[model samples]
Target: MSKLEIHQIPVLNDNYLYLIKDPDSDAVAIVDPAVAEPVQEKLDELGWRLTHILNTHHHFDHTGANLELKEKTGCIIVGSKADADRIPGIDIQLEDGDIFEFGTQKARIFEVSGHTLGHIAYWFEGSDALFCGDTLFALGCGRLFEGTPAQMWHSLSKFLTLPDRTKVYCAHEYTEANARFALSVEPQNAALQQRFEDILALRAKGQPTVPSTLGEEKNTNPFLRPDSPDLQETLGMGGADLIDIFAETRARKDSF
Candidate 1:
């Protein structure tokens, strides 16, 4: 079995910087190092050297520490080749459909480009793990900062196709607020209500909600269930097109 260890480096109040380690080879991979100091400290504490830095997008909060971390650890910084100019000092410029291995774990790159024009997500098929960045959140999706509604809809649809058991690691700890919104939309949804209570308790103890399974997300995340009657009705649009449903939800969340 492939060994996977995930570290959540809290940065900028709510952002999460993920460090994935393979014990067999002592290989390390970081997804979205928002800052250098904390990531550096965590790696030193764990005695793990970073081999690759996986970028989800070109946003400063996601890739700000890339150059500094690369310089400090001599690690390869990877991101969408199309975003090379935006994401500084990228070494491994990957495109959609690219597959590569880190130790015994292999990852497939998916161009989930709605969060940013060239955003990407990494999937470890063997581990059933997904580093989705800002594309799909615990119970929501990122605001449409760059891409169109249609683009975001398409990107989210791709994620919804993954196996329900896939573990999703997003870049932030917005689950509490997101679950609150989800409950508002699906008040009668037993799963959403239960999840809200569970996550509330988790946060109450000052814990981090990092990895959420795709099965749980499918059951409670309304953004991924635009076709569901509950979500469609909540948006006040009956039989609305997928793009419209996505747009409405995103608009509501921007103010939420």
Candidate 2:
């Protein structure tokens, strides 16, 4: 069993920050820290020293605490080389395919852009975890803020290369609303219907619905299933260009 401990810290209206600890070496890292206080409090509670800060993009919410946390903990910050100029206090700039060693566990970086032009995900191979910041969500994707539908599609498609059981640790709690859009586009998908029900129940109980499995997302997420017949038909883009189908679905969701 993997001993990589990940603690979820919810902050400021729907954001999820991951505090990850590697058991073998006491290496601790927090992914996309928006606020400094909660992270610092958590560190004190666990009596663990923060070592690194992992950022997937240059968004303000993701990098807000970079300076404070670095000064407070003397933690090194890691981010994409392409967007290093925007990432506050970034110490190690990495590009796609680079390996980031975290104590005993390591993450293979995948530059999954489109949420932001330089957004990247850290796929911890042996840990069965993917810290995908804002590119892919539970059932939806990030809006095309600085990239195109084609870029987002290409970015999301990389997840298909990952193992079925890989846990997708996206940076938000958007599953319930994303499910509504997914069902509207692919109502015929039994798996998606059931997932929607499950999402509603989870949200109703004030629980998180993130970290959905790659296999489950591939089987149900409409954004990931643009080529599926039901979703295509629902969008009236039967046999349309794959990107076109995805674009239309995303357009509709933008208004949703």
Candidate 3:
């Protein structure tokens, strides 16, 4: 089996920054760091040298820790060129189809510009791991702050094409609340109900319900399943495209 370890660094409320490590090579990469202190402490504990700083968007909550962390480790900051002005100290501006090595594997960058104007997600194809930041979440998606409904639609559509087994590593711990909204939209969805129950059990024990696979999200995540006849009909917008359903679901959650 391939050796890939993903660490969740809880920072600033429920946000879960990630540390991607390769045991064999002892190389480490951090994704969407919101705070530097916690990440620095973890790196010291693991005795791992930071190699790359992978950012998903230009939001301060996501890239605020970039300069501080890079100052300490001298690691290169990688983010989308379109948002270069917003992301601090971005040394390497990445675009779609760009491939960069993290440790023992390489990550293919996909331009997922919905959550933010220049948002991008990293896919480590060899290990079937995805560092999606806020573009794709466990049971929800990021609020559309920059892009339009159509842009978000096309972006999520591309992600749904990835292999079902790919593990999704989102940047925050918003699963429980998102699941609640999901239940409202798809009341009879057995998969959604079962997942909500499972999450409740985990949280009841003070556990983190994250790193859900693409297959699980596909079955349960409403934002990703706009084509479901049940959900489409319930919204009173049957025959509407994925973008229409996505917009409606997002609007409902905004008020929820």
Candidate 4:
């Protein structure tokens, strides 16, 4: 299979809109476009027409451009079946484990609820790329807007089973702030400390710290490390259930 070309377009303060293209067939898909103008501009520049719009959830920041983009390009909008009523212009309703194709590329849907009950992520096995909207972030996870800590933990556990080399493409650029909060939780984590410094340097240069590998996040993201003894000890929750540890970590982050 030919390699897929992915472009990251920054919009609406910190949200990222991804434009993916299949080089073999020149088919294009845009993920979670917060606005239409910028996405349209990028599509014109790439000389690629949008054929699909993949929505991870029904949040405005993620689906605000769906209707406009669909009207403009006649692209089919794909989103979670659970949120069909909330997602605008949805053409395809996807359930967990459902597979869809964009040209030669195939993606499996994962219903990862936490940030939102119907939140879903797209995993492209061939490309080892995961488009996880707000459910998970680079160093942080999304706030519990409509789901419980246990639900979020269960959702996150699904991601942990993915290949370590999978590339994580979260929606927002909140890594720097998340790193600061992570340090307070596990100051002795050598890997987390190193990653914090690396993120600092990247942000200093006005660079993005996204597209981080799952392996790297496993080492550094506190939200994904409820099983870490150090973190559990820091939270004074040693021998606690993983769900309890996760809840405490998320609660601390809320105040941090």
Instruction: Identify the leading candidate in terms of lDDT.
Output: 4
Each model's lDDT comes to: 0.86, 0.92, 0.88, 0.93
**How well is each residue in 81-189 modelled by candidate 1, as lDDT tens digits?**
8788898779888888899678878889988877788899999887888998999899988888888889998988888888998999999899999998888777878
Alpha-carbon RMSD to native, per candidate = 1.3, 1.0, 1.3, 0.7
**Candidate 3 runs further than 4 Å off:** none
Estimate, for each residue in 1-256, the C-alpha lDDT of model 2 and write its tens digit. Answer: 3568999999999999999999889789999999999999999999999999999998988999999999998999999999999999999999999999989899999998898998999999898999999999999999999999999999999988999999999999989888888888888999988988888888889999988999999999888887799888898889999999989989999998
TM-score of 1: 0.95
What global local distance difference test value does model 3 have?
0.88
In order of appearance, the predictions have TM-scores of 0.95, 0.98, 0.96, 0.99
Ranking by TM-score: 4, 2, 3, 1
* Residue lDDT tens for model 4, 1-256: 9767999999988999899998888679999989999999998897889999999999999999999999988999999999999999998999998998888999999999999999999999888999999999998999999999999999999999999999999999999999999999989999999998999999999999998999998998899998999999899998999999999999999999
Q: What are the per-residue Cα lDDT tens digits for candidate 3 across 118-154?
A: 8999998888888888889999999898888888878
Give the range where candidate 1 is weakest over 10 consecutive residues by summed lDDT.
1-10
